[model samples]
Target chain A: MTNTTHLIRDARILGGERADILLRGGRIEAIGPGLAADGAQVVDAAGAVALPGLVDLHTHLREPGREDAETVATGSRSAAMGGYTAVFAMANTDPVADTAGVVEQVWRLGREAGHCDVHPVGAVTRGLGGEHLAELGAMADSAAGVRVFSDDGMCVSDALLMRRALEYVKAFDGVVAQHAQEPRLTEGAQMNEGVVSDRLGLAGWPAVAEEAVIARDCLLAEHVGSRLHICHVSTKGSVQIIRWAKSRGCDVTAEVTPHHLLLTDDLAESYDPIYKVNPPLRTAEDVEALREGLADGTIDVVATDHAPHPSEAKETEWCHAAMGMLGLETALSVVQHTMVDTGLLDWAGVARRMSETPARIGRLTGQGRPLAVGEPANVTLYDTSAERVVDAAAMASKSMNSPFNGMTLPGRVAATFLRGVPTVLDGKIQ
Target chain B: MRHLLSAGDLTLDEATLVLDTAKELAQVGGRSVKKLPTLRGRTVVNLFYEDSTRTRISFEAAAKRMSADVINFSAKGSSVSKGESLKDTALTLQAMGADGVVIRHSASGAAHRLAEWVDGAVVNAGDGTHEHPTQALLDAYTIRERMGRLDGLRVAVVGDIRHSRVARSNVLLLNTLGAEVTLVAPPTLLPVSVRTWPCSVSYDLDEVLPKSDVVMMLRVQAERMNAAFFPTAREYSRRYGLDGDRFARMPDHAIVMHPGPMIRGMEISAEVADSPRSTIVEQVANGVSVRMAVLYLLLSGSGSGTGN
Candidate 1:
């Protein structure tokens, strides 16, 4: 029971005018220039930019299995440190979050952890097999009340199954986030299909493999009049398709990962598996196109897709190693460096893309609220001028597979208030 | 060089040094003693994840001729099959005082990964479809031994260019050696990014055969058609196969070469493979001397001295 009152002083709200914020009983009591409350914990937040706490629509907690890689408690702590107030945990766990029982168990674990609200994303297929549909209605009606369904790690490749899943989710106002990839076109794929894969003689993962699926799913969603969300749009061709779909007024939304907006396939030249990912990192032109799409609202939100792996999974040879990188802890810093600091998006735009829009997409009612009176006190204070050299050993997650280990990135989270309860203070988890 | 992982890492001077050393070392194959004391105390380990009896034996013979101790570690029946990772295997070899590791893996860039873990010199035998640097060296040696020069020679590498590690290394090395190389393969057989390679690509094999001073044929795996890369074995052999009719179009001084265990009826006909112009047999013989030169240059501090 967190009932403590907190007074945050001289913070810039939403990159706007500096003011004092008074939070009491998990609600914003007042916002003014010189607010004072007796017995309130005073946080000297001068020169910090305050925004709505971030929300991640895609994060892999790796619980109920693969605890050696990450657990709910560890992953949530990482999210809280990254200024995320809510996260939709992915459905690619060991038992697969397809049944009501699994999602309820994950929800209870998140409540116990008390760092961030964990919304378990139900699997659209049984065990993500891509053959048959899972119990979508049961999961939506469960205590967890899963509103987002996805077969993230594996694409719902079968067309009929995808169309059925999209239509079924509409009954409960749930969105089907598709991991767009054509399996046959990406057989034995190692990296992006381009000059780099050819020079290295590695197997090529062509962009058409991803674009073909997104194009098909968009038309299917338009036909069924169901909401569709594309996960991890990685190619320029995908951006063009998504832009065209939005122009057609289809109930379609898309997300670009923090990695996709910054990193490119040239990093794979080192043969380091840490750069390996699904839909593989693409070219510089693709990165620019994704940034443009996000700026123009063609892409709806920025999802972390925070995948963690054990050291053994990433330390092996490139082809034999797993395909993911740590993103939760460094996601905000990357966005600030690539998007905010570059003048592509302002702080208010950052709040909408990173917090408000993701919350709306996942239907997280308690998150992504404005810093105003009577709203939920979920606020993040960020020192925008500060720089951090990412250190994997110092991270909250259990795995050390961070691709940004030695990178010097801008901005640091000073404090994160999850429902007026300070989960992080002075850049340290409380 | 500390590592011979890719032919692209070699300069013209370094490649010429290797070929010149192999030329001097070839005479040792005929000597009664046949062994050199240059690397007498060194240890070389052949860590092979893929089975290739010919390459393994050639490397073994090269190491033995230089009087180095050899240990062969095959993936089958080894700890590698027992779930031990490549890093662990490399650490175990490093602990055993291996001075050099000759690795053959099915994954591209495996040798580069092993080089980062071990302190010894790493030599790539054949890593997936990436590179086989020593094979290129031996091919270069065979070409130079026959024609006595590599400058401005017209070479055509035909068939299965997309899946051939040998063709990749040959193109890079031959281009560095001042030879103009043409990659002759069906459009489906060539990689989509072949335009970026330092060679010209052609679908017609016969058109380039007459102009080619050296013709190298890469083996075509029958399993490629399982992915629909080509139609059938008969059709592929008819169009791209180097029969005697295509061989007659080549210049009189031109040589035919194939890295062996040749499929007689598939990529190259038996007549062309057994012809007097064929250097296929000499390629195998030159593989040992070229490997010896590489091992000596990498391990010994003799500064390219003759192994007397």
Candidate 2:
């Protein structure tokens, strides 16, 4: 709905040759050297990388139930700040986004916020009970058009039920995103099972628990001839399984979270709940495998899984603490550090993994499009040379549970244009 | 010596100092004047989240013998039962100006978490299946008393090593003291990563028993049977339990110890438990002296100045 003409000058188009991008209405009007402004607002992006606005395949915008943690409006603002033009909202909310009404309501909230596009993910189970199937057809047919179905925080552990959900989603060209975990193997799991868990006396969440379920689901997806998306693949064993499944040509896509790529289970030595998370932070070797997997395109996207929790939920004993950390505001910086700074991926590769592939996985066409003329002007200006210490309190999200708090991270989102409208300008919300 | 949260935190020298100090304090147990004024004005709080009459009273007696004011905060009658968090309870204890906080909780790392919230010295009484440094100290003191030396001594710790905090603390502390220790338990009753521990592990107690100078039996909770850690108590007892015939395999000078509230005829025979070689009763008495040494060394400025 924006008509503001903007002339973004001397920005490296996907870290390539410098060009002037003229955004008119909601599409790119022109892209060339020294383009005329014609009374348009001029932004000096002389040293920034201009790529497609980022898209997250996984995000928990806790609304309609746990508004105390994060709402759609605040989560959308946080997303805009993170250079994300769109995010897939997880369905594990209070009322549970199982029906069409909840999905439509969540979609409406994102529209009203005007910061970013929020695609509501429908629950695969009725209440994520892992027993009966939810009304997946109704959710996909609703105004929200939920294409991704998941029982994210809780896994659909029942094998027969998982097969049915994977098969049912094929009616709408939908992809079933599974939070892969074998429930019994991970019962009373506190952190990663290893020498560390053995030393600390915390219950171990073994890698086989996640790998077993992922292996089963990949086979199910291949047998049913349906597309399956694995959410937040954490273990190195999981990467090998997905890579093996791809060799057999299973229509499966996988994502790795920002924290999983950087943090490891050794942080649990402090017994601080801030380090506590689901599929809990793994080993350094696993981190290397994940980075390698993402670089090789074995892992298609870098989903935020930007789960936020209230302070009370995280400030207690490790076992009593909640299971996620804030990721929307820190996702790109972590990727820049763990991927680009390591010389494993260039800026163009980043656009593919963080934006293009994620959008393709979510079936999002408006997002992940190239920054060429006549395309939707979803652009992000990133200052790759910049660095700042992450301050949890300064984040746009309602919760102050960022695990990266006080850690210096590279890259800053200088500006974000969502459909020609400046959602973020000069690193501040418009 | 700011916090005795884990037995692994102790060095050889620090553990020796505690044992030497406890030996001196053990003399006070035989004297008519059993009280020491070293910690006269200090306040010690026993903040127990789990019901452990034995551990709580041992800590209370230790603090009282040193003339420190003791306050027992059991979770049953407190605001903790009404949903007060551990951090909130820690802050409350902090407000009361506790010089040392002795905590026993059902959650592992609860003591470590409390250490972050309070400035006072923290002593872990027992935390989940994690560690009980004081219990290990007393067990170590009793072994040293009977064996005359810890170096080159063979020790076998049998039963539920997975859930026994005593076994974890003893393995770490005893290994630090230069004792060659072996853990004897069923594969399911032992942690999978026990190979990484400083001590050796075994499944057969009889094989480990004859080579031991000290045989310590850990209590196998009856509830562990329902969880199928073992098929039945009889099956576990037949394989790993200590009885007369098993005890006969130990060296003549070797001692039998249990961190008590014994599950009679299950993990140990009543006859062996009451045998002259058994130090079960003396371990309880030695617990007071060892805890007194820990408190004095951690709280008194002079003792802590040179301590770990």
Q: Compared with the true structure, what per-residue lDDT tens digits does model 1 show for residues A14-75?
A: 88899999989899899989897677999989779999999999999999998999999999
Question: Fnat of each prediction?
Answer: 0.73, 0.57
Per-residue lDDT of model 2, residues B32-72, tens digit only: 98898878878899998888998889889889998888999
What DockQ would you assign to candidate 2? 0.72
lDDT of 1: 0.92
TM-score of each: 0.98, 0.98
What lDDT score is found at residue B140 in candidate 1?
95
Which sections of candidate 2 miss by over 4 Å? A1-3, B302-308
Reference contacts reproduced by model 2: 0.57
- Candidate 2 chain A: worst-modelled 10 consecutive residues by lDDT: A1-10
True contact recovery of candidate 1: 0.73
Candidate-wise lDDT, in order: 0.92, 0.93
Interface RMSD of each: 0.8, 0.9
